[model samples]
Target chain A: MASKRIGKQTVKIESPVSIAATAAIAGPKEGDGPLRLYFDMIIEDEMWGEKSWEKAESKIVKETFSRLLSKADKTTGEIDYVIAGDLLNQCIAANFGLRDSEIPFFGVFGACSTIAESMQLGTMLIDGGYADNVVALTSSHFCSAEKQFRFPLELGTQRPPTSQWTVTGSGAVLLTNQGSGPYITYLTTGKIVDMGIKDANNMGAAMAPAAVDTIATHFKDTGLPIDYYDLIVTGDLGLVGKTICADLLKRHGFDISDRYNDCGVMIFDCKRQDVHSGGSGCACSATVFAGFIYQEMMKGNLNRVLFVPTGALMSTTSTQQGESIPAIAHAVSVERDLSS
Target chain B: MYNIMTKKEYEKYAEKIAPKSNIVRNTARAFVVGGLICVVGQIITNFLKSKGYDMDDTSNLTALIMILIGIIFTGLNVYDELGRFAGAGSIVPITGFANSIVSPAMEFKSEGFIMGVGAKMFVIAGPVLVYGISASVVIGIIYYLLNF
Candidate 1:
């Protein structure tokens, strides 16, 4: 049964997939932040007793997966596929973390937009009757990301105001073909949009246009009004990008000023935490969605929500080569089942 | 509201929303911190020379002592704070190099001697050593050829 394809990029999932269970673990810095209570585990140690930040990240992912599965009362044998990624090169965290799990793995790389991308793919797999249980996970460690993307922690380099702190956390969500509620109903795949801005420090600027473009496209495709959903969230677009995204959407006559929220901006208290713009990275949206947003949905406080996770697709090599950052975003509509 | 604009319009709006850098403040901070580091080096050299050490020995000893201090500070996790505050001031000095190597080494020490500390010790400093030594060799060959 082929589902209805909305306008160009939107897929209206006829049989929506349900989020069975979600688990999130955060590092010390994120533990100290405002959303600490939302996370399942807040490890005081950034290294999590691991040798390196990379290993620490892997440890976080593995733990989050186990916790999520346990919470769903499922074993590795029951899971169909594990879709995961991180901010490391080649998605090494997912590779090494789930190596011994014996579950079939699908490694995805969408920069920070990995969570939404994974969920969208997971929903498609379930809706398409390919698999039953799929776990979509993403992790990002501040130290590991900083070492790869910018300066080493030892360098103590001054971060600019526009720069965002990569969230040190991992979040996992269990998407299943059969579950009670909080169903994934639609997905809007974003096109790569580059505005020729090459500054890696200001990733929010590089990613905002893509977010706006995708949001506009989602509304156009679904023929849904701005008020169709209770909430509209963007992944990892910090304070600077949030304003720009809203302004751009407003210019197109969709003023979501009151309903819009950003995962990056929501994760940390920018003023107190010294996290200049806000948080970014794969875990920025991952932890926020798995921890805060999903919990909100489960509690029945919110019904329909549009989650658009944005990513600035640029590597250190690409930035060094003076290539402009190409940004992308993926949208998923999650709604609570009225009957359930 | 209905019409999509050209790329030029998008660029203009993006430029308006982007964060601006405080160039003057950053430059002044870098200058003060960098100058202070140099002054400390000079003082250490003068003190070493006053102790009857030769110029060559004093210079070597000064570098060794500075690096030792940097490693100790890095071990204590204080050098990173200085780095955050001083920016280029902290990075331009030999101490920064010492900090770079020691920090990763200490962080990865938990992985054991060989694969962890030994392998990752040069994670940050590896590129600097490679380029620095390679450039020096190239310059040496050029100098030798010209003189010969």
Candidate 2:
């Protein structure tokens, strides 16, 4: 196998799974953000004329996957497998989205960390010689997520300040055994970490410790210095979680303050947008990386990026039953070999 | 990745650090909004009373009018925005109760009128009704026992 399991939870891939292509579709509100220009498509209507938000989310997944395949100049038949997930019950968006594609599918569920989870699995399948090409994607709709996890959309209730808005978008990335250079090099699987946080509204604080744990584990297992990467980004730690994550990293003897960023915090201008904390959900990191960071890497602005997608794995039932939020974060190291 | 803190300690620490909504601002907004809702009711009451309706009819009419406005605003999708800005101002009134019921009904309409709208209509307000009625019954029983 080309992929070697390293000390503890890290995996080192010898042949490096190349990122063939990436696609992202953002909602109108996200299109107005700083990363707006990076998205392939900005949907003007939230529902996109669909009868329901769930169907609209599935359409987003389908379109994003189609665009990714087209960008790579490969048909669905040419791909070995498609790994996808979403922040919906039964992973409905992914299952229904790719049903007609006829490609072998792997439905995953890691809550918001689904992007990194899918990408890691896809890269492993390729590096292990089980497949030549694989597509990894995830989607999250703000309305659908709120309907399933929080409350009805029309509920006249105020959002607390610590709350993060679920990002309305979808992103897909194509990974192949052979391609010109930006490659996925390492993977660090995360363990469920709970700090007794029961408040569902304050997801940022709940998910931050998990990010801190995974980041610290990755560096320890790989024996890599914090300065090795140009950027260390988390999935949806928003402003509150991002700050706490940085602080915790410093305490872990890894002061990753300068080059660190969070997808949730970056996706929206919280100060101006009034989104309380910032953007979240499965698509937060997915769209940000597929649209913004990947473009920055392709532009030679960044050579190495440690992408960590965080998830708060809790249901309304679990929270209502007084269970703490169990959070997880998976990390992948992607480096661009531009000189070659 | 030993966090060096107990779960309870971490919970307390996390709560302390997280940003809190400005209570004073929220309270002020709620006060203004709730007071205005009451003022609207009072005006409606005065209007109906001036037209020779009894106090009982005027009060009931005032509640009916406010509830109608609430449902209308909810259907228009503008009440949530007001609720967001006004906090509990739009929530503690008769209209808030109407929103709590009608909002879920409209949202769940996709599931079908019988299961979705009818079944889910009272999800948010169901507890309020349950506890309110239960408390009233308990108080009535206590009063009867005391009289006996």
Candidate 3:
């Protein structure tokens, strides 16, 4: 029998899916960060010999996917689906990178929350017995994201202090039905929440409300205490959004300050790195989890973690048309299967 | 236990949390950089004049030289660094315009000359050219009609 559904927004997977292997690749800037040692490959060149930043991003995705498959000792033929996305328009990086793979691809878009979104779908597919193995991945490049969303690098637009740098990295996780376990057990899908924030520079402010709403709903649905998990990690709230999220959660009678951490904050030393608030991108959370967090879990340092990746959904066209940023967050609970 | 906020209230909170801007610093940088670029043009114009060129001819020669410098810097990948440092200072000049055109062209040169360099060379500066030429034509027609 499948595990019972907890509440309206949460799912409890009956058969927990294991992450067989994972790989993370980042550009030089991310390599210089505090989490540098955790990443598998840190290419010195941002372009990675590609002609354009967009093409470079595609290379990052392809390299990460290939690395994950190799680590797991599985061919692309063994994988049932390649579930991925990127911050690029139409997720061009994933589409172009995986075009030659010939695997069944499901391209998704949840902005920066794509990692968790893809993982949720991948986990569901495996737990439902629809696929034996699936690979979930996402990527984002700073230059490419800047070109698409803001002014070109040649324009030299000054970034606001509230602005977070988009991480130039890709992370891929190979999920299998059976493995030495750090199993995905539950997931909570988030709603699109908007607080009418119009500024594109302040993504953390736009996305925090959605993250708070999702976390609160997740706790209520699972009937779990704040300490149920060792850590509750947010995708890329950075400094600004993390503070706002804490305050909002406190008002809701839950204090998650001690247990809470954000991938954006974890990925970089904001002050020293000149990243201002922190890092923000689809790759931000993906690389952090695949590199640092997963390794920690494997070493028995952490038992359970609730990973919530948040995203601010706003296109340049929408923002130019005076539309407010709407945000979403998706949560996945990964537990170390000690019994197995 | 969640306390829901109205859109207005949330916006107010968001505004308070937004980063403060240092307009004085930004403006100073822009002014210095922009002035320096103009000074370079002026120096070039003066040099051409000293070499016996007329005022109109000197101005055209100065623009061409500046654009050539911009293209060289872009090819060497140095213009983007200058842009990073100067912000709008490096961008509000003819050299900046030249950099914009040459940079994308060089970047896409690998995708083959026709579809890549030829097609995408104006990806960044295409709109500027279109509007600039159209506006100039409109202004010239208006001035002629009024003067006539």
Q: Which candidate number would show the highest TM-score if scored against the true structure?
A: 2
| Candidates sorted by TM-score, best first | 2, 3, 1
Instruction: For candidate 1, give the lDDT.
Output: 0.89
lDDT for each candidate structure = 0.89, 0.92, 0.89
Model 1 is docked with a DockQ of: 0.43
lDDT of 3 by residue, A1-340 (tens): 3356788889987786898988999989899999999999999988889788889999999999999999999998999999999999889999999999989999999999999999999998998889999999999999889877876555434678889999999998988897877998889999999888898989999999999999999999888899988999999998889989988899898799999999999999998988988999999999999999899999999889999999999999999899999999999998997343
Error of 2 at B128 (Å): 0.7
Model 1, A10-38: lDDT tens per residue?
99888758999999999888888989999
Q: What DockQ do you compute for every candidate structure?
A: 0.43, 0.80, 0.38
Query: What are the per-residue Cα lDDT tens digits for candidate 2 across B1-148?
Result: 6497788887887888789889999999999988998998889889999999998888889899999999999999998988998878999899999999999998888789999999999999999999999999999999999999
Task: Please give the range of 10 consecutive residues that has the lowest summed lDDT in model 2 chain B.
Answer: B1-10
Q: What is the C-alpha RMSD of each candidate to the true structure, in Å?
A: 3.5, 1.5, 2.8
Interface RMSD of 3: 2.9
TM-score of chain A of each: 0.98, 0.98, 0.98
In model 2, the runs with Cα more than 4 Å from the true position are A1-3, A338-340, B145-148
Docking class of 1: acceptable
Interface root-mean-square deviation for each candidate?
A: 3.4, 1.0, 2.9
